[model samples]
Target: MRIALFVTCLNDALFPQAGIATVTVLERLGHTVAFPAAQSCCGQMHANTGYAAPARQLERLTEDAFAGQDAIVSPSGSCVAHLRAHTALPVYELSELLVDVLGVTDVGATFPHRVTYHPTCHGLRMLRLGDRPTALLRAVRGLDLVDLPEPEQCCGFGGTFALKNAAVSGAMLADKCASAASTGAEYLAAADNSCLAHIGGGLARHPGAPKPIHYAEILAATGGIRE
Candidate 1:
């Protein structure tokens, strides 16, 4: 499959490894991954923050970016959910593409670490990803997948919500961090780095917190080495 990777702005700027790991997993599966340089932010932030006009414009530009691809795949569920709602083009989150469209579970990965997954709101509520991510994790060669307490709880990183509702966001993040830490996992994985960034920022303040990681990075691992 010739897949166009929609590297979301957050991953492109701060979490490039997630994007790279996504491509790594796809190519390792014997599929061609294309990067459309014209792709930019899918305008999710703008739309969520009530700037509908600019959001619409950016959505159009994003649509044009991957105009003629077999499918558009993104590492971030938040952006994929936004684009899927706005555009007519086919957009799939990494897990969706791997499990539903491609009909493959084990991507020949090996990561020997205890890990827990936190389902982001967009992926859980909007995309309804369900167990696709966990199914893939379970297939990893040596990974120990632990159950996150309250796995469906939001991390309170609803884009601009973190900035606008600082106190509430912090309180929610503290609860999430506590839950993740309780699992005794070495890493906390999720599909959306936006939520990871928020949770990671909170986890970083404390010593001995589970390191935040994207699931793609785990899937891209070979011989127990993370990307």
Candidate 2:
């Protein structure tokens, strides 16, 4: 498959590892992947913030990135979900495709510590990704997939909404972190880096709660870090 990597703006700046890990996972699976230079933000931030006009630019950029590709995949569920909500094609969530389409039960990554999943709003609600990530995590040899206290709650990092409403976002992060902490998981994993960044920023300010990690990192661990 000729796959294009959508290294989302947040992940490109804050968590390059997640994007790198995503490419690593896809390439390790014997698929061809491309990083289109024209790719930029998927415009979820603009769309969510009543700036749908600029989002069309994103659609243009993504359409360019997806040109002639067999499938388009990304580590960020929010972006993928946003596009899926708008268009129709073989675009897939990394976990959804990894488990359902790719048939990769074992990538050889080792995450011995227990971890809980925090599904982002657009990904969970819009994308409708249920427990497929957990199912794949449970299949890992030494992974301990702990139950998240509230599996369906938002991480309060609604892209630019977090900055637009920090107080409410903080409260939502507090609730999310408290629940994740209650699970005693070493990692708080999710599909979207944008929410993870907000949750992680909140956790950094809070007294407890582990920092958030991307599900792609776990999948990359199966093959271990490339660099």
Name the candidate that leads on lDDT: 1
For model 2, how does the per-residue alpha-carbon lDDT over 126-197 read when each residue is reduced to its tens digit? 777787777767766677888888778777777676788989887888899888888888788888877787
**lDDT tens readout by residue for model 1, 1-227:** 66999989989999999999999999998998999999999998899888999999999999899898889999999899999998887999999999999999999999999999999999999999999999999999989999999988899888888999999998999999999999999999999998998999999988888999999999999987777
CA shift of 212, model 1, Å: 0.2
C-alpha displacement of 18 in model 1, angstroms?
Answer: 0.8
| Candidate topping TM-score | 1
Candidate 1 error regions (>4 Å) = none
